[model samples]
Target: MTALFDVILPVFLVVGFGYLVCWRRWLTEVAVDGVMRFAQNFALPVLLFGAIARLDLGANYNPLLLLAFYSGALLSFALGTGLSFYWLRRPIEDAIAIGFVCLFSNSLLLGVPITERAYGPEAMLGNFTIISVHSPLLYTFGITAMEFARARGQNLSVGGVALRALSGVLHTPLVIGILGGFAMNLLTQAGLVMPEGFWAAVRMMSSAALPAALFGLGGVLYRYRPEGEARAIAMCCCISLLLHPAVTFGLGRIFALNLAEMRSAVVTAAMPPGVNAYLFAALYGVAKRVSASAVLVATGLSMLTVWFWLAALP
Candidate 1:
């Protein structure tokens, strides 16, 4: 219990502090937006770049681990979309947005800190590996689905849809960082070494990634107050917090993943929908309320759900 609290509370407390600041009007919404922009576009990307650049890709890039985590994410997306569209009677676009909420977990903000606290820095290999392709893969899938849905009865061709999806994925700051890191990694393999001073600057920025992002995230969620769509919100929370991790766990066991691999897969799978989830909805102007509310509600519920998963993990 102490360990669980240690792993979870500090993260949430920082998030809570940001919420309090926003709730009290200590910072304007514009200020909060600036903070998030800095964190997401600059600090967090640099962190990913550093992590990926220094990663021993040959040793840590486990296909089985990736399979378990991503398979669960895709499954959750399908279920969330199908249920929202068919059962909940949402518009096709809205269904796609809600599915994105289930698809993109808070892998960086919540997953990294919790897993690091529970295991150690060495365990980050799996997390970073997953993160490297995470945004690109999921965003591509989500965008393709959304474009297809939107393009129905329009004159848009299949190639046009694929091109737009690919364009969107490539334009992401996170994906740019990952691609740059991979390029750097390759250069390093070719006997290139970055200077210590350069790394020092990278570390400085990387250090601010999580705290700044988490705090800004709280403020962002404050704006997205839980309004209507109670049923859809509840479904998103369940799928993101419970079902996704369960599927990852089952797959991990089937693949005989080692303890570190299992922990990384399940913990990352278990994170609430990321701020990106809401961003995706906002970008498309569909189901924004549901996406935003899911991020807010699911994050609050993750405190207990993450603990349960940690305890249940082998």
Candidate 2:
């Protein structure tokens, strides 16, 4: 219990601080945007590269664990989308957005830091590996989900869709950083060595990534207020916090993951919805309300859900 409190309180404190700053108008949307841009484009990439460069990828690679995690995510995505479509009676696009909110989590922002704090820095390698496997699916299938929402009755363009899909991969700093790190790791394995100063610089830059990300998330929460969309947002949060994690936990057990790994997987599964869903919805101008509501709802409720899972775990 003490460990759990130690882990959870800092998160809420940061979030609360963000909420207060926003409420006081001390952190404007413009400031939030600038912070997000820096975190996404610069700091996060350095963090990713540094993480991957230092990983002992050859020995630690667990194909079965990766398969189980990805499979669980895919199943969760399908189940979330199908159930939302059936229950909500909404358009495919809106359903897709809600479903996405149910499955895709703020793994990079919240998952990394929390897991690192709970399990230590070594856990980050497993976390990043899971993220790398999910990134392609997120880029391809995730964009398709949004496009489905936005296209409505219009005829789909294969060429345009392909270009857009590829663009998603090329534009993501996370993906770029992962690839760059993998390349460097390969070179290092073959006997390449960097000067001490260069390594120190990379370490310095990487250290800033987590705090910046958490603060950016807080700033975003300040800007996001559910307002009139409370009911819909609540529904989305219920699915994201309760149903999604429950299903993932069951799957993890069925796959016979060890207790520690199972707990980690559950925490990862219970993460709040990704903010990228809102960004994509805004970019495509489709189901923006649902996307925004999901972000607000999932983030607001995740504190409780995370605590519950942590307590429930051994």
Candidate 3:
């Protein structure tokens, strides 16, 4: 009860406030777009850069931890894709888009803040470890899959498709931030020290990342109402909120992860699909409605599901 009130509700309250303001027409779409642009393109990338630049890669990058969390993610993707195609009769393209909803978790906005509130700042090393590669790995995989799905009967070369996927992943702002951080870390390790003002500016921007992102995310969710595709939405919510974390938890135990690692892996796996799910679907013009609705519905469902996972985690 205490954790539910103290740790979880505050985060959702911010999100809810965003939704409320947008629903009431107090905040216009243009304003929301600007806010999201600033958060995603600037603040959040700065946050990732600072965190990764400071991280001790050797100590924090645990293979078992990565395996446990990502194994669950891949399993959910495969299961979601297979079920959507075989049972739901969705097109191959739509099925891959839906599978992406299952694959990509909101590790940065929701996962980081909630984990920080529930545990502490230090416990976030594992969370950062997962996030550093989250976008690159999943986006590459999702884009490649979608490209292949679209390329069938279109005379597209496999090599060309692969290159396009790689190019898209490389150009993402988040991935750019991560690669920059790695470069900085390597430079600092070699005795190159940056000025204090640079770090001060990084801190300033980093502080605004989550609050702005969450509020922007709320307004974005408001735009994606649950109109139709009830069954597909339900399946996505189940896979994202329940199955992903369940697999991570089981694998965490199997891998004998420590308490912090267990919490990070399970909680991150439990996050709803990020807005990128919608963006991916929109990019390819497939399953746009289902992807958008799944993000909104699964986000609402995650409040209760995350509380349960928190209680269940040791």
What are the RMSDs of all candidates, in order?
0.9, 2.5, 0.9
For this target, which candidate reaches the highest lDDT against the unseen true structure? 3
For model 1, state the Cα shift of residue 34 in Å: 0.8
Sort all candidates by lDDT, best to worst.
Answer: 3, 1, 2
Each candidate: how many clashes?
A: 0, 1, 0
Candidate 1: where is the Cα deviation over 4 Å?
none
Q: What is the TM-score of each candidate against the true structure?
A: 0.98, 0.89, 0.98
lDDT of 2 by residue, 1-314 (tens): 66457886786677677667778888787887788788888888888888787777875566755665656566666766776678667667667766666667787888887777777776666677667656656667878766655676788786787678778776688788878888888999999998899889888988887777777778887666676655557776776677766766777777786665665667777788878868766766656787776787788778778889777766
State the lDDT at 97 in candidate 2: 66
Clashing pairs in 2: 93-149
lDDT of 3 by residue, 1-314 (tens): 98889998999999998899899999999999999999999999999999999999999899999999999999999999999999999999999999999999999999999999999999899999999999999999999998898788898888999899999999989999999999999999999999999999999999999999999999999999987998999999999999999999999999999999999999999999999999999999999999999999999989999999999998
Winner on TM-score between 2 and 3 is 3
lDDT for residue 109 in candidate 2, whole number 0-100: 81
In model 1, which residue pairs have backbone atoms overlapping below 3 Å? none
Better of 2 and 3 by lDDT: 3
Give a tens-digit lDDT track for model 1, residues 10-81.
899889989999999999999999999999899999999999999898998989999999999999999999
